[model samples]
Target: MASIKQREDGVWRARYRDEVGKEHARHFALRRDAQRWLDEVAAAVVTGQYVDPKAGRITWDEWTREWMERQSWAMGTHEAAAVAVQSVPWREGQISSVKSSHVQAWVAGESKRGLAASTIKTRLNYIQMSFRAAVADRVIATNPALGVKAPRSRRAEAAMRILTAEEVREALDAADEFRGFVEVCVFAGLRLGEAAGLQLRDVNFLGRSITVARQVQGSTIKAARIVAPKYESERTVYVPDELMTSLAAHVTRAQVTAPDEQLFVTPLGRLWNRNNAAGEWRRVRKDARLPDEVTLHTLRHTFASNLIAQGCDVVTVQRALGHSTPSITLNVYSHLWPSAEDKTRSATASFMGEIRDSADSVRTETEKPQVRGSRYR
Candidate 1:
């Protein structure tokens, strides 16, 4: 229900009862202005787009706090989300008022602050998600950040490195005490943290399978917490007999008999964290004389690339890498699928060749040897 009335004070008042019967009102200088406001409100209600005027009054800071509490995030994702939301430029203002211009300005500000393009893009994604949720909750009519563009991250793409067969061997030999750790990453495609969280129980030596159940979620030994794999990508990766034998030898060498004991650990038997793992990786890279651009994660890329080289399909590569979806696998490693264009040409040539062969075989005898052949003569 809605109404527009002129009071004795010469003010035009517009009033409406919302879907829940809560009343809202505003006073305007002109009767036409009050009527126009009522019409807009009625349209919004009929279109199922009605948002209570006061609902958007909550600030971005307050909304994000409530939103974060309701999300079920892994430890690492929660930390990243915390950092991302806190980094937004206008936390104190009403979230509904944030416009696309504000989001663009924030992107520009992040660039000026010397943040990496990828980092700025990630932060922008979080801001977009927040506004999208706000729109869904009826706290805002639209997502202001939906159309905002983020700066492109070119450096990371340019630096992607895939190793060859010999390079993989050299890197493994140079890994020294970390050989088994590097092997699992290169052969099984485990992320650094996933390999760190690997336990004896997760390995099926006879079956040559390793189950990815959890990951170490922090950089420091003291702060490290075991959590489910990223994006719930818990899965089993099958290994070659050679790699399985290597893991068996590693167990014997490390004397890790207990099923719960971590297969890969520091000399102090502590779980490997990124910081410590990076230091060792540097030594391995330098000793192996590999390109400086090759990081530990590159080994996982190499594994994926090798799978593509072996003619594995997208789902096979995605499952091997524990990617949440085949689209993500393609997004990251589509270049490695060498058969896309090749298969097109080959398929066309194969069918055309069959047509040509059929025509040649069925040709009339008159078209065959006109020269002196015994049968033709």
Candidate 2:
């Protein structure tokens, strides 16, 4: 039974037992207001949607740290999120009090700070994921980030540059020690981490395929550790015979002592990370006469572009790039897929020619019947 009593100050105090039989009291100026609050509390308890008001008092930074600790994200993902969190003032604010407008404003601020669109998207993802965790814990009703947009400004719309075959040849020629590494990237579309983590056992020399099963990821290049391929990108990708030959020569020169040894590494066998061959990569790009903006990752986009120009299917490209979904692959490289303008003309011509042939055959049959005096007549 609910209880309503007039206090010494003449305010009405309503007392009620919640679902767990915990007593809670709230004061109101009028008896009816207290009664209304009690009724709403009863309804909420019956609906199993009741939330403790104090549960969401924790700051966003605390909750995000808790949630991040519970997640088994890769080291690179963790590092990226940490970098974004450092700049977020909302991390110190209450998680429940954050509104959609606040998130939108924050995204706009990040864009104005000259952060790239991709980096801003990563920050937004961190925010969205934290809010989603709060929702799962019943600390908040919804995720504010769901309604927010990480604006992609004009500066973020640079067109992707694909290297020509001559440029690829020149880069490989100047690559010197890193030639095999560059070849694998341009020829097989292997990500830097994936290429760095490749072991001798994962390659099938006779089959001419490299199985991507692991990758290097950590806070620092020298301190990196091996983990499973990103986004479940573990799959087999075939390389050309010439690339296979190059790989073989590189491995032989490396003097690999163990079949399980990593294929590419320093002369002393210190495992390679993205930074290990930076000097070699710079020299290769410069000697090839490529622009300063051309990074080693540029080979990945070039690989996809070349495959698409050669009429590779979307699903195949998605698999090759280890994209989580075909839509992701399409979103980045959809334009590369052949529009087949030449094929469109050929298709129309073939259909019209078939119709003409059918009409001619019918007309000849009708004319022969009348011209030769039909056998039936």
Give all candidates' CA lDDT scores: 0.88, 0.82
Candidate 2 residue runs with Cα over 4 Å from true position:
1-4, 14-16, 26-49, 84-86, 153-158, 275-283, 286-289, 340-342, 346-377
Tens digit per residue, CA lDDT, model 1, 1-377: 88888899999999999889899999999999999999999899889888998999999999998988898877777777778889877889988788899889989999999887888888888888888889899999888888888887775346568888899889988988899999999999999999999999999999999999989988788888788888858999999999999999999999999998899999887889988998899999999999887899999988887888888999998988888889998888877776568989988999999999888878865477666658855
Cα RMSD, each candidate: 5.9, 7.0
To one decimal, what is the Cα RMSD in angstroms of model 1 from the true structure? 5.9
Clash counts for all predictions: 0, 0
**Candidate 1 clashing pairs, residues 3+ apart or interchain:** none
Q: Write the per-residue lDDT of candidate 2 for residues 1-377, one digit (tens) a residue.
A: 57899999999999987556778889999999998998887776677556666668889888888888998887888887777766677777788788999888888898889887877988888888888878878787667889687876333125677888898999988988778789888999988888888898887889999999998875355678898988769999987898888888988987765778888875566766767666567878888899987887889889988888888899999998999899999889876765579679878999999999999999998878444666896
TM-score, cand. 2: 0.80
Q: Residue 173: error of model 1 in Å?
A: 4.3
Ten consecutive residues with minimal summed lDDT in candidate 1? 151-160
